[model samples]
Target: MKALVLAAGTGTRLRPVTHTGAKQLVPIANKPVLFYALEAISAAGIANVGIVVEPNADDIKKAVGDGSRFGVDVTYICQEQPLGLAHAVLVSQDFLGSDDFLMYLGDNYVGGGVTSVVEAFRHDRPSARILLTQVPDPTAFGVAELDDTGRVASLEEKPTRPKSDLAVMGVYLFTSEIHEGIREIKPSARGELEITHAIQWLIEQGRDVTATVNTSYWRDTGNVADILEVNRHVLDTTEGPGAAAGEVDPDSTLIGEVHLEEGARIVRSWVEGPVVIGAGTLITDARIGPYTSIAEDCRVSGSAIRSSILLSGSTVDGVSAIADSLIGRHASITTAAAGGDSHRLVLGDHTRIALAG
Candidate 1:
């Protein structure tokens, strides 16, 4: 079996950041979320992988390369536009060939990984199988209606009135039959060829469609909240190798759960855990704590950073505090503005703000 990872979307929701980088490349605990997916795919024993990317394919290609790093033979398929999920599969037909494959959303995060799912699919070889989870708001997702016997009877894509709370998770198992289904379908009112419609068509044609209720954690990291939530979830389970205090001053007080990467220096600061300070970062006279991922080459001085994911090349100036935020690459946050004593930020577009005085 092969794997197809859809990463073509423009990620409008994560703009400014997405404006410069692919959403899949955004760091969760200083590691790209896309890397996690690739790791999962590799762990599942599927090495031949096809990645569907947008016009900015070079960025993703450069980061993932030939997928050799992740133990997968990678193929990059370009999507002319953000048409839809089914359209992505349609374009990747050549790469996918006749093998049953796993279609994974590049920006989606499944907590337990797809190893077991892949194992089960390989064993049973169903025409198509969908991962489902009971969501509070099924209206936001493609929902599945289960029969009395617990079989998937119908599928609806973001319906006005959901028949079930079971939302279709981003992970999907598909056989070669989906190509024909994609070819036969028409675009939805949204002018996109949705995969949900194709699956419904397969079910209508009596194809052996199965649904597995995902009990483990699964999140589609489309928005900011989901991204942070996934980050927190991943960190909660992550056990670091303790604080690798490289250049810690005697006055500095480092507490539990700090991961100071190589060349990271902490001086006269108090740090509490689950903090992951990236390589070559400097933390001086600062309070770093709980749920902070400071990316490589960052400079933090006399500041407090908590519950945030700071991308590479950012700097937090003296006396500034940031929490519960996603800081973009090369961003600078300072204590004083040009006019007076107010926070100043050289930020990008779609930047969400909840300022603290």
Candidate 2:
């Protein structure tokens, strides 16, 4: 079996960070989100993998080249536009020819991996298998309606009045039978071919389409709030006192579950985790704790950052406190007023701001 990872979407919700980098490349626990999907797929014993990407595919290519690093044979399938999920599958037909495949959204985070899901699908060999999870807002996702027997009866894409709370997760298992379904589907009102429509087509034709409700954590890291939520979820369950690879000064005090990637420097600071400090980042005389991720090459000094995500190349000057925020790449936050603005911010492209004040 092969795996097809859809990563072509231009993450408009993530803004400045996605402006500079792919949302799938965003880091959690100092590891890219794409890496998690790749790792899980690799663990599921699927080797031949195809990644669907947009025009900005160079960065992804550079990051996962040939997939050898992740123990899989990588193939890049170009999608000229972010049309939709079904469109992505239609474009990858050649790469996925004749083989049962798994489609994983590169930005989605599924706890405990998909090895079990793969096993269950392999055992059943249905026309299509989709993962579902109970989400608070089913209208935001492809919602599913189950029958009295608990089998999925129908599925709708972002319905106004959802029939069930079971929202379709990003992962999918499909046989070549889906090719015809994809071809028969029409574009939705959003001007994109919806995957949910194709699945509904299969159902209309009496194909056996199954769904597994995920009790484990699963998140479609689409918006800023969901991204931070996923980070927090991962940190909460990850093993305590994460892998340390970089330098820690003698004066620094590290506490709780923290992940310091290689080349990270912690000096004269108190870091309490559930936190991930990426490579080449420097932390000095600061307090980083309980759900904070400081990305690569960032500098933090004499500041306190909690429950925040500071993207690569950001800087927090002395006496600053950034809490429950998402700081864009190369952004500068300082306590000193600039042009009488109390706090100064030199933000990057596509940046989003929600200040407490």
Best by TM-score: 1
Error of 2 at 94 (Å): 0.9
**Could you tell me how far off, in angstroms, the CA of residue 25 lies in candidate 2 after the best superposition?**
0.7
Taking the tens digit of each residue's C-alpha lDDT, what string does model 1 give over 66-95? 999999999999999999999999999988
For model 1, what is the C-alpha lDDT against the true structure? 0.86
Stretches > 4 Å off in candidate 2: 240-244, 338-357
Best by lDDT: 1
After superposition, which runs of candidate 1 have C-alpha atoms over 4 Å from their true positions?
A: 337-357
**TM-scores for the candidates:** 0.94, 0.92
